[model samples]
Target: MYQLTFFLEEFLAQYWQKKPTIIKGGFKHFVDPISPDELAGLAMEEEVDSRYIAKKDDQWEVQHGPLTFDNTPEDNWSFIVQAANHWHEGAAQLVTPFRQLPGWLFDDLMISYSTPSGGVGPHIDQYDVFIVQGSGKRHWRVGEKRDDYEEEFRHSALRQIKGFEPIIDEVLETGDILYIPPGFPHDGYSVETSMSFSVGFRSPKKQELLSTFADFVISNDIGDVHYHNPLLSTRSCNGAISEQDYHDLETMMRSLLDNPHLLKQWMGEHLSQNRHELDIVPSDPEWSNEETYQCLMNGDSFNRISGLRAFYHDAQPEIIFINGGQYTLPDECADTAKQFCNEQVVTAKSLGNAIHHPAVLTLLTQLINLGYWYLVE
Candidate 1:
């Protein structure tokens, strides 16, 4: 199990999104949950998002996967697979220590296996990442924050920046962690053959918000109110939109913002949605309400699929949004709903009256059958 050497509150207030900080031996005596061979096996799978990057004498190349290492040389290359937690139960355990943060803000776990002198080159990521060294050693150099750096792309899959000066340069051993915030140029190369696990957080861009909101508006049948002006005054310039017109337009736009209920629903649905594909398979035989309730009473537990996004809003207290779907709870089952949203593991004991609530039972049964939530065997 990974252990934190420093306090989370202090780390969040001091360094999160503001600067880079390295915690030596963050997971003291850390034993990697997944091995390099396991990671390489995942890279060959069709559904997994994997990449292979190689650098040879200043020339860099990148290849997208599902890939195999049969034809490629072993040295001077790195193999990366994204959302390992979603597919492997062992990889999912790595996420246990970081649950103190908001559940919805989590993106996924990305693991990389690198050979000697292997790296992806200097690049800037727009999301926060906690890069944990799993095995062997890696030398990391993190540069200062700069948005205007020119990018050089040798291949369509790779975009790299030139000449990054280090703000933090160190060799990280097994269990060491390096935290880098958004827009900070950073690069990591294997001092030896190494494995690194990255726990990343979501930072949605403005364009993404606008695009997803447009979809939400169309789907929900909201924001359809046409602008109507009851008071029309004579204007000197017909082409000009006067201050009143601007104000009216702004108010019309703000209608989406002003509707708290609608905004909450949209956010709940949007935030819970996953950007990557999930390795979910519906149960061949669906669980019935009676079967689910009986299992709950029999002391059977439930585990949420790792990397599953779940959230609730204060404005929509009874609704638990998860995996792009909304599950409404009874007033009596609100506490239970919070547990389901906040926890990766769920027990029958913590459910209280939710187990007996007919609507909640039905919803749980459906989710279990759909494989979003599974019965612990």
Candidate 2:
């Protein structure tokens, strides 16, 4: 297992979302969990979100995968595979150390393999990221957050800035980590044939939240109350919306936001969804509740599938969300639900007597059948 040499609390308090910093030798004597060849293989898959970027003749070119390296560029090219953790178990372990942050904020583990002088160009990301240097070395330049930086499209799909005065510039060796927060302009190029693993975290924007909440409301028929105004004064102009009319309409909309239960439900469903496709394969022959329970009691453990989002709010501990679906637990099984959400592996011993409860056993069976969790072989 990989471990960070730096103190997480000090890092979070001093540098998180405030500025960019390089933690030298973050993982002492680091060993790459996934190799360049394995990353390339993942990029070849249709379900994977990968990109090939190259610059030739001072012009940038971008290709969206599934890619083939039949006519590969000799240099000045990079191959990036997004959400590698969703499909690769070894790659998924890279995110375990960073679980100190909110799990819902995590986006994915994006792995990139770059040849000498290969880079995606200077760009700004709207999400936080920790770029962990693997084998070989990379030169990274990070600029402070600035709203005045102009964005230019080098390629149709690539948005890059012309250049920025770098605040933090260094060449990172193996095991070094660079932490960059959202809105920071940064660029990195491989000093040699190198692999970099980026663990990204992002929170929902207001627009996204509003749109998703609206959809949830429509789907569940939760906020169908029509606007009502009992006393309406005659208006001088029909086109003019009165102050009282605006107030009443605003209140009507605000009523939905005021409901704590509605907000919690929306948050649980929204945050539990994985932005990338999960590698889920349901059991061919579904295990019955009794069989699943018997297996668990017999020392079998269930491992949660990589990139499956599972979480429960502290305010509503009885309700847990998994992959956009919410399940309410029995009072006696609340701790079990919390364990399933917090831990990647579930064992009969870990669950204690909760595994014996018929309701809990049934839920576990259902989840396993749905492919969210699988028996460890």
Candidate 3:
């Protein structure tokens, strides 16, 4: 694992949601997390979120895929296929070890698979992303964030610039990372058969908040607290419950949100868990320590858990909601706790600790069985 302290000396102070910063080979001996073929196979699955945009005769056409390349377009087009890591186990593993960057730094790890002549066109992204060059070469045209930025062509899920502008335009070799902050208009084209890992961080917009709030209400046992017009007792025939009724409804909703107990807990659960579920296919549960094993171990080598965190509050808590589920730990189990909150790793010690709570064990077994975690010998 790449140590944070080592990078701290040169760490970009304003990295989290700030301007773009590219650190070449930031993770030493960094290899492409997943292969192009693996990513391509993932794009075929329907349950996983995936999208593709390719230029068609100077026009951009976007499509959902389990797609195969047609003619290996020679020019004037590129394709971006997103959320590859979410759908495929092999790909998701690439992202799992990088949990040091908190899930919030990742909207999802989208693998852009393109043909030599392919490109997604110039576009502005509202989210931050690290474009890691994988196999082959890609020519990138990126401009620093500008107030004049506006997308010229917009298809569903695809945004393109009206004209090309480049503050930094160049070719990226395999293993190079190009960081782009939100609001920057950029484009990428494959110089040869190419792929890019777009590690995106898409924060919830205000509308998403209202949406999740409704989901929060539905998921949790929020007893139906309707608008109760206490004023009906007054028998005011003068109007249909007055603007005061609206006020009362607002107050009721506000109170529910303001509920110190439930709101706080719900937010914790929601933020801890991801909106999308990780396809945690498990491997058979085996703890027989081999060389990759220790007779007894502390969290290390993907086991000694460190650097678990929550992003919204920049908050760290003992427990977290992950992979659409809640996993709890005592405040003392900080490392394991951080592991659960920050990643999908299921540690043996953590499992052993929850032995009394058989339910936790059962869930852990399923996760292990699903290949989500194993002793990282």
lDDT string for model 1 (27-69, tens) is 8888889887788888899999999999777777788889888
RMSD vs true structure, all candidates: 1.6, 1.1, 5.6
Worst 10 residues of 3 by lDDT: 303-312
What C-alpha lDDT values do all the predictions have? 0.86, 0.92, 0.60
TM-scores, all candidates, are 0.95, 0.98, 0.72
Ranking by TM-score: 2, 1, 3
RMSD of 3: 5.6
Task: Report the C-alpha lDDT of model 2 over 1-377, residue by residue, as the tens digit.
Answer: 98999988999999998999999999998998998888889999999999999998789989999988889888899999999999899999989999888999999999999999999999999998999999989999999898999988778899899889999999999999999999999999999999999999997899999999999989999877777777767776989887788988898899889999989988998999999999999988999998898888789899999999999999777799999999888987888889989999989889898887888888889999999999985
Lowest-lDDT window of 10 residues in candidate 2?
227-236
Ranking of all predicted structures according to lDDT, beginning with the best and ending with the worst: 2, 1, 3
Which 10-residue window of candidate 1 scores lowest in summed lDDT? 345-354
**Residue 368 accuracy (lDDT) in model 1:** 84
Q: How does residue 84 of candidate 3 score in lDDT?
A: 62
